[model samples]
Target: MEKTKVFTLVFKTLFFLLIALFFSWGIWNGYFSMIFTESERFLLLLQQHLLLVVTSSLMAVAVAIPLGIFVTRPRFAKSEWFVLNTANLGQTIPVIAILAIVMTYLGIGFNTAVFALFVFSLLPILRNTVAGLNSVDPAMKDAAKGMGLTPMQTLWRIEMPNAMFTIMAGVRTAIVMNIGTAALASLVGGGGLGDLIFAGINLRDNAYLFSGAVPVTLLALTVDGLLRLSERIFIPKGLQEAAKSA
Candidate 1:
């Protein structure tokens, strides 16, 4: 515990120092000269990026969860293999290829970008949901059922609560993946922080690139940390107490 706490403290200190260095560099380069104006644009770009990630990821979760549950159950024996193979195939398809296919059929811009992202984002969430749900203790499930709980109630009240950490872990992975992949949205004329990155690349300007890369990386880390924090919080109180006793 002491070691873990020390590590967490070190990480926090390093993260703050990175932020300080990023701002100081920006200021020295006149990048932060018009602080308010640059800040607004930076935030707007982040908003767009966040929108794309959240929307597409949630859409994926919506589709993935029900299908994950359905396929994992014994009654859907035949469909299980099909769902697994399809998600496997989805993961193998390159983002660029998916974007091209989407653009051809769905036209360009945000809608097409979302569709491509949805496809890219589905596999992890689907696979994790199935894995977490499957890993639930059979004894606990039987106890829930014996208590006269409906299947839905058992899922929501028992299985899901227990699987919270695992599910959040999958969500953290999906979010990080989406943040990186969302940059491809630029290919379809979908404006995002990717514009900053590509603009920098075209201009051979490192500052322009760092302007985007820094924020995106920070966002991913922040979100991932928060999810992990939430996983800690959502762990059953009894479990924490037991751990403390041990």
Candidate 2:
């Protein structure tokens, strides 16, 4: 590889290493122990938090992508605004309100919290997907159709590839939001980092609160970074370069 490429790789590696080291130093001094005590289930809470976020984000992607695609069709073109507005309306409600409503009907548990988080995570993705697909060059779409590609083939090969970065942006937003919102799950008997923070609040312990909050923040950052990496990997090289330049 060229010297410039080698230097860039080394720099990126060290940057991440520094972050790992920072966390390691904090852990070494018992900074993390404040949350992880002899009997405390810190790891379990962390696991639950991650599970909720991942599951809810995945569910949102599954629904939002298809829904976004469906609404952009000619048959649904006139109703697109109505459907998107409905999704926008969902976002207007407070997440806690949505959670409570679901809890009331669905009962308190992991599943209910997931449902609420899924609702909260939907708008960004749905809006971005529609916008992304719509933003595709109409001429390119026509060209695709003229080349004997079926509608679905044109969408899959031309539209989605061109729109991938935008779609991934939506996915990234939802994932981060999902992570933060998943903390609320604890309020409804859904175990997660939020339980720790709430427990610390009740007990007036800063350590416990930071323990939960810090990890959640870090988790969000890590996930966001991973998504960016995934986007770079999946995005067309020319588009990636264009994005970087822009």
Candidate 3:
């Protein structure tokens, strides 16, 4: 089992290294010559893309985690459906339509894109958080209480820790979706790798298309990889071993 795990790790590392080398070769050889010649701002665009995904994800986390926790309480339990429905409603609309509608009111800029992305990111995180908490073993809660833990203590120490794996799964889904959606921000003057994609489309340049697509794909994979590491580090050790054995 350990040998298989090591082989899997090596394979993934080598795969990522090969992809990194390929992209580096493309950029170094000026495959995007047309793009750089017009404007030398590839790095700037990549940063903007990261900013969009990170900022919007953070904003969603701020609200979703707390709201999820709140709604699970017996006093606030009745509100869960309403809150979840509201998040689900935001997700029902197509992203393009949401961007177009939001742009009309917000007037097409970085902020508008952020607002649209934030709305797009809410449902998964919120839903998973509620599910994670609710799925916590009832016996564990009773044990915590029997040991003289307060409701808040039981939640923070026991419930939250046990539920963290599920919560992180939600976050991973949100961020991955956010990364893909962020590429569309270019349509609204929100600069990201999408600009290169659209530029390629407009100018009929495959170089520009690849220059944009490659980096965005790498970023998503890299972020997901990092979050996977986080899961290993944060999940209770027993759960991790159970996962491995399973």
Candidate 4:
């Protein structure tokens, strides 16, 4: 354990050092000059990008979690295939195509982007939720019933805790994907770092391209890291130890 901790510390230190070095190189090469030259606009686009990610992710969570839970219930077991396939269909469709369809109906804007993103982000989370719950031990559920616990009690106390790590894994996947997809929102005038990215492409400007690409990459990494930390904090300690052992 001590060796593990030490290795982790060393790894983190090296990681941060590499990030610092990369940014310093970017500064030297003027790759990030747009941030300084067009600070206000850059900031605005960044804010819009974050808003797009947060709003859509939250919406996905709200809809997906319940839908996932619903389809997992024994009463709805027969419908699970249909629901999963529907979500899978949404995911299988190209995100750009989804955006285009949404744009056709909504006529483009932040709301249009959010709706499209919400659709795109739903499947992973819903699938994970169902899988996590389904993976819970039947013996455990039986034991809870023998103890006279109500169905709801068993679900909340015995099931959800065990399933949380998997569900959160899905959420992390969805959110990280959403962050990257949000960049495409610029194509529809949804207003985000995509504006910079597409602009750079059209104008053949490296600075504009890197400005958008770097931030999107960093944001995804940062959010994924935070979600991992949250999983560590929120997942039951016994499960964490069990996971490590596994």
lDDT of each: 0.81, 0.89, 0.91, 0.95
Most accurate candidate by lDDT: 4
Report the alpha-carbon TM-score of model 1 versus the true structure: 0.82
Residue by residue across 135-173, what tens digits does model 2's lDDT show?
Answer: 999999999999899999988988998998889999999
lDDT of 4 by residue, 68-164 (tens): 8888888889999999999999999999999999998999899889999999999999999999999999999999999999988998898889999
| Ordering by TM-score | 4, 2, 3, 1
Off by over 4 Å in 3: 1-39
Model 4 off-target regions past 4 Å?
Answer: 1-25
- Top TM-score model: 4
Which candidate order results from sorting by lDDT in descending order?
4, 3, 2, 1
Q: Give the Å shift of residue 237 in candidate 2.
A: 2.7
What would the TM-score be for candidate 3 when compared with the true structure?
0.85
Report the candidate with higher TM-score, 2 versus 4. 4
**CA displacement after TM-score superposition, residue 106 of candidate 4 (Å):** 1.0
Which window of 10 residues has the lowest lDDT sum in candidate 2? 31-40
TM-score of each candidate?
A: 0.82, 0.86, 0.85, 0.91
